[model samples]
Target: MIDFWLAAGLLLLVALSFLLIPVLRGRRAQLEEDRTALNVALYQERVAELQTQQQEGVLDAVQMDAGRAEAARELLADTEGVAAPRVSRLGKPLPLLAAILVPVLGLGLYLHFGASDKVELTREFAQAPQSMEEMTRRLERAVAAQPDSAEGLYFLGRTYMAQDRPADAAKIFERTVNLAGRQPELLGQWAQAQYFADGKKWSDKIQSLTDEALKADPKEVTSLGLLGIAAFEAERYQDAIDYWNRLLVQLPPDDNSRSALQGGITRATEKLQASGGKVAQAPAAKVAALLKVHVDLAAELKDKVKPGDSVFIFARATSGPPAPLAAKRLTVADLPVTVELGDADAMMPQLKLSNFPEVQLVARISRAGQPTAGEWVGRSQPLASSTTVPQRLIIDSPDK
Candidate 1:
């Protein structure tokens, strides 16, 4: 901001120069005009002296004429190079007044419209914060500066949560949801924050938020973890185990949280067993089937599609529900690209590639960006889910 202000001041100086330079030049021109007039008066005085000498019979007519001509020559020499006096319609005061007002008006307009606060925020974020409190302060200022910025609000909410200010986090998350729409991840964050903000007591509002989030995305990790924690707190050991188990499946093997989640599941199982309840055995781990596919637009449909159109690729069970078992999304600009789909890409918790024995591949191009419905589509013949061969799918037929 210091540098920014310095640059702005320099520009203002440059602008002031444009206005002031002309007025200064006009003053210099006025001095030249005055000097020219002085020279004319001196010439006239010399001529009057010469005429007096001629009238006193000290000089003849020819001498008098020569003397007068010499006086005129001297006047011309003194006034040589003096330009014609220029008349300014604006006068002297107007330009000077303008020079004074230019900077003031410019600064006023800039303050009214410029993004100085945002610029300062950017500069502050460029360096690593010295402490968590300092970082939190900066995030708070950023959110204040851009109240409508969903990303800023989201980060502020997360920072508040980390600082154990759950009440503040809940409010910020609610603002984030309002600005960014009720996205699954945001809803999960909001629910978790609200749950903690309410003194760890469950409420219908938190339940609704979590349900909506999980319904939109069953693998929403935050909501799953929150539900598990709530169940464990309420002494519902079996329910806690179920939620934790679901969450465990979504975590990657290398994730640092996996061990902690496994520890939680073990604790819940032990609690359930202590209560004389029969614990369900964990399912056998199965290797997820990964299918590599190359998708492209059919040459015949090249003219029928736009570059910005959406492309959805998926595998569905050949004889079961129409819902995709695994799916990926792309754009028409990324056509002729290779993608891999597996259990990790399942749209729902119960639907997975490993659950199906045989499936068919599909590629759809939608101008409206709808995955289920599109303008054109293509499909592959039913094949075993475990097939390792890379299949090619081209979208050519009109969608029914």
Candidate 2:
């Protein structure tokens, strides 16, 4: 802090000195021009008097001419060495003294009283150290001070949300909306808060709010996504499908939501497929989707286990449990080193993991290199393979 203030003081002094220079220069120039003008006027008046004497026959032409020449010479000599009005570029050394003294004084004061050692002092000061309740009180005060400040209202609402006071949050957000006017993102965020505050029951009001947001911004991804989820929850599967489909087109190809979209599509499609709904059959080659998972065991576990070693190799589905999702286990001494599954497999087909599909199988290897389970070992995450062919898995949390 001392160093900063010293530097700032020096910079300010330098700037003031720079500004002073222009003023001094202008004054000096004006003085020099005035001196020059006076000299010229004096010479002209003397020459005029000399000429008048010669014309009045008071003096000879030679005398008048000599007088005029002498006046001219004197005028030239007076003006020749006339200094360019120096305003003592060094202004009495008082400013220089002040410049040095002020910084030193400022540094001393800062070191003694005002210096903060932490780099985050400014940030800490801006965002005070306080509980959520205290912050809310401060926010309320700030809002009262400046009722129309969008920033104040925004932070106040966010603070309410952070405190899990969704009703308060909704109220603040609604007030902000009224004051600041409609913003699709803000509207969606506020609507969510309102929905949670009012309970999860689906209401036309929530739908209307979401629809209004979507109308303002058709590709408002969060609102559209939430709307899809709400529709699915309401058993409006077709509506969910349509909303998700529209959202899918707007989403990037590799977005996480693609997985959810594929899940919704599959659920909808499965119902349609079972209901004998007409699916326009495309050409055999053109109508293709791929879903696949590849497993590579850790190098430490490879080719080290003996026949007696308990080894478990199976595929567990990724959706929910109680769906017979796991594949039949095989030992390390099994006939084929690599097991590949495809569409022909009834339980777990070899399908492209794309189409944002969930993992249909989990290949587990026990920690003891045995099927019985010393400690269940294998990748817990659903491996992303391909999305061209979609499939579903019924996976519960690992605790199951």
Which candidate number maximizes TM-score?
Answer: 1
Give Cα-based local distance difference scores for all models: 0.91, 0.62
lDDT of 1 at 6: 96
Q: What digit string (tens of lDDT, one per residue) describes model 1 on residues 1-400?
A: 7889999999999999999999999989999999999999999899999989998999999999999999989998999898999989999999999998999999899899988988988998999999999999999899888888999999999999999999999999999999998887999999999999999999999999999987666667899999999999999988889899988888778989999999998998888898899788766877789999999888998888888999999999885556899999888889889999998999986678876788999999899999989999999999999999999998889999
Off by over 4 Å in 1: 282-394, 397-400
Task: lDDT for model 1, please.
Answer: 0.91
Candidate 2 lDDT over 245-290, as tens digits, reads: 7677766777787997888877866675676764443224322323
Each model's backbone clash number: 0, 27
